[model samples]
Target chain A: MKLMIYAAALFAGMSLSIEGAIYGELGKSIGKLESSFYNFFVGTIILAVVLLFFGKGSLSHTFKAPKWQLTGGLLGIFYLTILIVSIPLVGVGLSMISVIVGQMIMSIVIEHKGWLGSSPSKIQKEKAAAVVLMAASLFLIF
Target chain B: MSILILAAAVIGGVLLSAQSSINGAFSKQAGTYESTFLTFASGALVLFVGILFFGQGDISAILDAPKWQLSAVWFGVGYLFLTVLAVPKIGVIATNISTVIGQLSMGILIDHYGWFGGLQIPFDWQRGVAIVLMLAALRLIYIADRKSALQKKQAA
Candidate 1:
């Protein structure tokens, strides 16, 4: 558990710091659609090579999956474009604050409903406290 | 503008969390980087198809773009690996809170100096206090994690 927490700290700290700002700036110069397209374009080429050489996984199941299961890519389309545009208008910190809050609320809902075929976990008091702190931080962040 | 931006940010957040869990599940079947690769590959295909069907943007604009501006893809790769891996270990709350703290600090730095050509939004006292509180919450969450861990240890 301790080791996991430490690892999470290291990786989570690295995320949301630079990417949105960079993507936002790219969107500014090249347009959001084009910028996002290039991001995925480059990402695809690199991943394709890795998938071919390093991946032992098969895409057969992926093709057989339901349409909803495959919509992760569609979600990425919205997320990439939204962050790109939001950063320019609201600044990086505020934009991410919004993302955090959005995720928080929806997570609470997902937890309560167990919407995605997972076992339902009830929200504990400590989690509620954390949520309040996050909510308070949002006003200051904006 | 504020409303629109806030809505967009919220939507991005929801997607971010959802993808973390989804990709975490994917990591069970594939190598860590392999999972990341598959995600990007799928996303790329979607974007390409979107372009074919409805992207009204100029293709030349992307090709004509400067080289250095397209560096965020690597960051995407990094974030995805970390997110997919982290969620399984630390759960979503810890994963996201840590991510937000790092992102805010870096974001403030970038915004302070206007890095990456973004319009500068100078960091101020209100933002500072908010950040401090959020950091404190990290400690709070970690402590909770430890306590629960200890309880499990005792029960075991």
Candidate 2:
């Protein structure tokens, strides 16, 4: 279980790095909407392929996504499009710093309240301090 | 120019993080691919709506998008899947941090090497310090988890 979690973490990181590169490149060329739309359109194709091969009967399960899941999709579009747009404008360093700061702030509320079905955990002082320090470091570097 | 760029990055980061959390919420209820597809599909829907309501509805923009730009959608799909898979196992905080660290580490390399373009940011002392701090934060989070786990084991 732990190994799977670690593997997931590694993959998550790698995915983010790829995303940063894509944003950096795409931001220079296409407008936000076009870039994002095309990206998702392509993603749909890839997902379709997976469904046809390894997915088997799993494709049907995806259509049943709840109404709230739409919110997640909307957020994905906004976040990704913005990230792509920002990379060219701001540069990756500053963009990353700002995003991390926002994330740290929001994460506290999300985790504490269990807003997203996350296992509840208190926003202890140590964690809070760590977030603050991390933010500060990001600012200094950027 | 630098200020504007930084602002964009900040906005992008916040929006992405929030969206990821929303995706996380959906992932908890639905299966991973379902959540992934819903997020992308909904995002597409929102974009289309925005084009009609606010944008000029420029078909040219969509048509003109480079082939490579379109290819990035697959990466987005993969990213969503990874997030869904990791968030539940590592918890939100850890998963987010790990990804950020991964991004920064790779981003710095990409920038320094000018892999995509001739633009490169030299790795100065400040960047090194930032990397160390990030690693330390991860360590602290890990230690906290271990402490909690040991306590539970002792109690059991």
Candidate 3:
């Protein structure tokens, strides 16, 4: 069961890589901001249609939800914009590694704190080692 | 890289983790597609205003793009949808690391194959070692999480 969840996450990551490449081309053809706009714009339409047929929850609950939780969209935009800006300044390799390290560190903190409604998982030596190894691997790959 | 640039890049990753966590929690309440739709809808609304003010590229260029290229949005959709489903179950660290491993693995394959007109960089020993190391890391994390989870269950 855990392995299945891991595989799903892995597949999600693979999809992201492909999307990144495609959007990279789109960004080159259009402006970066424009391409992003296009993505969200088109995505909104697509999801709207899907929700019409398949959605099962109340979107209105979204408004009643905590204000901070609604920042997903803003965070998404910030992430892409930051990468677009920082990758040019720092080399892609460094940027990529830094991002991975940051992700691991932040994730550890989030899990440990039970933030964002995630169950608390105390940090262990093995988990720390795993993060270190993963960071090292990214450094090598990029 | 300067410290500032490194910080910015890292913050980008931080935002990514936060986005996943938030979206995952939101999906539990609003349903996955509904949560995703709200995100894109809100994001599009903001970007529309951004484009109105600062967009420089010809937005019409998207219309001329190959049909396959447009399908990238679906890949993006799949990524977020899966992430929303995974994070609450696996926790943020596991989901994020797994995704990172997958992303890099796929990226290496794409580079090696020179897919999408990219430069053909042959697979080297370094990349192979890196992948092996990543797999090891994943295994270690899994065992660690499993051990802790089991302990918690026993304590309960």
Among these predictions, the greatest lDDT belongs to 3
Compose the digit string of candidate 3's lDDT tens values, residues B57-148.
88988889887778878888898779878988988668867887787777677667756543456788887887788778778877887787
Better of 2 and 3 by TM-score: 3
Report how far off residue A109 is in candidate 2 (Å): 1.2
Per DockQ, the best of the predicted structures is 3
User: Which candidate model has the greater DockQ, 1 or 2?
Assistant: 1
Put down candidate 2 lDDT per residue, A1-142, tens digits, no spaces: 7777766776667666566667567656655566666666666666656655654233354456555545766766766766776666545555666666666667667767877556566776666776767776777776
DockQ each: 0.52, 0.46, 0.58
By the lDDT metric, which is better: model 2 or model 3?
A: 3
Minimum summed lDDT over a 10-residue window in model 1 chain A is located at: A61-70
The all-Cα superposition gives candidate 2 an RMSD in Å to the true structure of 4.1
Chain A only: list TM-scores of all candidates.
Answer: 0.85, 0.76, 0.76
What is the C-alpha lDDT profile of model 1 across B52-148, one tens digit per residue?
Answer: 7776666567666666666677776777667767777776656766776777677778888898888798888988887777677556656655565
> How far does residue B48 in candidate 1 sit from its true spot (Å)?
2.4
How good is the docking of model 2, as DockQ?
0.46
* Fnat per candidate: 0.56, 0.49, 0.74
Q: lDDT tens digits, residues B22-86, model 2?
A: 76555555545655666566667777777666653344655675665555555556666687678
